[model samples]
Target: MTGFDSHLFEGRTVVVTGAGRGIGAAVAAAFLHCGASVIAHAGRDLSHAEGDLLSRVPSAARSRLVLLTEDLAAPDGGAQLADQVLARTGVIDVLVNNAGTMGGRIRAGEETAETYDHVLDLNIRSVVALTGCLLPALRASEQASIVNTVSISARAGGSAGSALYAGTKAFVSGWTKTLAKELAPDGIRVNAVSPGTIMTDFHRRYSTPEKLEATAAAIPLKRLGMADDCAPAYVFLAAGSLSGYVTGQVLEVNGGQLMP
Candidate 1:
């Protein structure tokens, strides 16, 4: 997919949250590759991400990249980022709401108020707050899109320890459809990409090697997915040329792990 023409996204401005690593990083890279000026946001700092990107991205792409490090969990985080982006660029062509988390496996009986709050805050609340902040910019674009990163867990109710996290993603999945209908009249497409058992730092913490092997064996593909594997779905959704008539849909990138 490299060597794309300069006109692909010549003047487009894309905002990708939680782009410091994993799928977020891959999404940012994909957008940059297609000639879009990308505003990549990280949660705390960009020290590690900066190094990672500098090592991979070409010099020309660096000029088009803007790395933002803001704590998305803060009450005013979304507004602050939105204001900054609007100040620099009048419009945001694409908004990828990919910042999320899966709190460790804890049963409903073992959960506490704080646990639920933390999980829900990052998974769903932040997406709503951030999108609200950028609605104006998104509405300003003649071709706008909001691609959310959901999970296959949402449909399955998740594995034993991930029920709460799955519930939050389920809310996002439902909201994506509702918002798509509401925003369709304005030409702003809303959709989601659901990834399954990707091999990333995320899984390193939540799933053991044995567990991953078992998961891979169970999948029809007999392999785990990479961050790159999931990035193209976001690009396809963001690119009006490809997914112009597509909206309110969930594109799953799980190698047939979950049919629904």
Candidate 2:
């Protein structure tokens, strides 16, 4: 079977959370294209994710892609997903923790405890729990990679109403570095990708047309990014053949929006 890079990860297995939409979908497709057996974990509902995925891939690669439906927001969801994966396959070579929500731009003064709890549990807690549950599976692989999807908001502190979302991403960035150190000895590299103003539903819900123009003007690239632009960063980090020496770092995919 031929993959994008001609079987770059012919025998690898990857789990991509939030694979039903946007960046997550793109990343999962990229892995499948490159010959990785992918467990595409879609949250809450499957919707048409499986059909959407098949539309973007070749028939040969279709068998390698497994659609896993689960609610990662549930308390036991992460463990359940991990168990399901291990039951199907003995090893997981890459873990892409990409499921997240912008939480719809509530002002700091207007944010409720309920809102805060939901954001933390889905964005932070679920990521940690899932990784913990899958450590053994990852350890079994010869090359293990964890790619956490951070955001340009993490470094820039977000726009007016997204402080909480930005804060959670900052925690992700810090945790990436620390976790990298802890896993380095195990040969399990941890890294993050910080995407800038990608034109996804994230901005469709929170950003106005005027706001988008201002953001585009501020960037040296003079335009907003597509979901595809950010997908390669995840693939790069996951392919140890490409980034084996790289770890504990954040790769910014912001089109020069923020130099850091």
Highest lDDT, which number? Answer: 2
Model 2 agreement with the true structure over 1-260: per-residue lDDT tens digits = 12358488898999999888778888888898888899988666888576555567688888998888777767777787788787888899999999888777878798897888777777898889889999999999999999999999899889888888999999999999999999999999999999999987778888999999998998899999987888888989999999999999999999899997
Model 1: how far residue 107 lies from native, Å = 1.9
User: Residue by residue across 159-241, what tens digits does model 1's lDDT show?
Assistant: 78888899999999999999999999999999999999999878988888999999999999989999889988999999999
TM-scores, each model vs. reference: 0.95, 0.95
Task: Estimate the lDDT of model 1.
Answer: 0.86
Any idea what lDDT model 2 has? 0.87
TM-score of 2: 0.95
Runs in model 1 lying further than 4 Å from the true structure: 1-6
